[model samples]
Target: MLRHEFQPGRLVAGLVFAAAGTVYAGDAAGLWDTPWFVIVPLVVGGLCLAGATATVTRGIRRRSGKKRLGRSTLDG
Candidate 1:
């Protein structure tokens, strides 16, 4: 049995990395120019930082018994 766990941080990171790989592959295949290889780390790092902040903030709010505006607290 597989446990259902929803982690948007990991998903965002994975998607960013996948996009970087796709860009590299496309460049290698003589596709459109993606000369901004440096963007990969910048984007990934930004996403990681944002994700971490969000996760921590959410955890803190949940622990404090506070509710966010849109996120449902329904446990189904």
Candidate 2:
């Protein structure tokens, strides 16, 4: 059986979500201080931005390659 490859970007996003949830849980448990609470939102927002950028970049690259191939075939 072929194993699926692991994606670091996806892993990072998952970890960020987990961490944010843990932080929220800690706050509910009265273990998290207000000063440290800002980190959770920042981490989650950063992960979202990174993931979106990665996806858009990959899509643009793929489309550019396809267009290049089409243009080359047309010129030939």
Candidate 3:
């Protein structure tokens, strides 16, 4: 039913970057002023968060995979 694996970490990272782009776009459109230094921390913090999320997700998937395999073996 799925074409590819869904990665939440990538999704979060993409949303963060999209937010940063939107901020700049708004500033360009005269909606608000964004400080030049704002993107630095935003991107860095987002990347860190994404990395952590990826780690957690990978751990979860691995554990679930092992459990599923174990159950299938027992059932068979």
Candidate 4:
């Protein structure tokens, strides 16, 4: 049995933030240059995409759950 439900939205968001952090780290380390305002859109877009993905995933799960419930009722 699984201990907890997996959250893909959080995973995507984490990856996005990690990428941004990596960019900043690179800049700090003098490996590359990152503009001060570059993070604004990166974070905002990532969050929006993650939210959309979560909504879609939830809808799909709910639909599948309803189908399973219906089948169980019919079989019993």
Candidate 5:
């Protein structure tokens, strides 16, 4: 069930965070510098936050059965 429960958006956001962390660590070595270095993490972090927020909201809605597509068998 974990596989079915997994959210694609969350996965993407996590990957973005992971990439940002990796880039930050690599740049910390001082081998290279770029103006976009600072901007990248902010953007990635924002995306992660947004994705997580959406995922949580969706989960809440689903748990409440507020977005079901059809009637239950008991209705019949």
Candidate 6:
């Protein structure tokens, strides 16, 4: 069986979008007092930004600790 890949970026973005949808749904039904437009972008964009930053940092750190191609530790 093939295993599913776990993606933190997609997960965080998806959760943010889902939450934004819920906020709109609640507002439409008069269950929420907050304005819809302001909160949705803030929530979604912030989470996406955080997710991107984390993904980039993780990649950078991983590469920084690894030996480069065409080079060996003994050559240093």
Q: Which candidate leads the pack in TM-score?
A: 4
lDDT of 6: 0.73
Worst 10 residues of 4 by lDDT: 1-10
- In model 3, the runs with Cα more than 4 Å from the true position are none
Tens-digit lDDT string for candidate 6 (1-76):
9998466666677777777778778888999676647775768686877688678867976787575633666577
| Number of the top lDDT candidate | 3
Q: Which stretches of candidate 2 lie over 4 Å from their true place?
A: 1-34
**C-alpha lDDT of all candidate models, in order:** 0.72, 0.77, 0.96, 0.94, 0.69, 0.73
Off by over 4 Å in 4: none
Query: What's the CA RMSD of model 1 in angstroms?
Result: 6.6
TM-score of each: 0.55, 0.50, 0.91, 0.94, 0.45, 0.56
Flag regions of model 6 displaced more than 4 Å: 34-36, 50-54, 57-76
Model 5 Cα displacement at 2 (Å)?
6.1
Model 5 gets an lDDT of 0.69
lDDT of 5 by residue, 14-62 (tens): 7677766776777787756645667666766769776877788688868
Provide the lowest-lDDT 10-residue window in model 6.
65-74
Candidate 3, 43: how far from true, in Å?
0.6
Model 4, span 31-69: residue lDDT tens:
998999999999999999899889988999999999999
The Cα RMSD of model 3 versus the native structure comes to 1.5
Residue-level lDDT of model 3, residues 1-76, one tens digit each, is: 7699989999989999999999999999999999999999999999999999999999999999999999999999
**Candidate 5 stretches greater than 4 Å from native:** 1-4, 34-37, 40-76
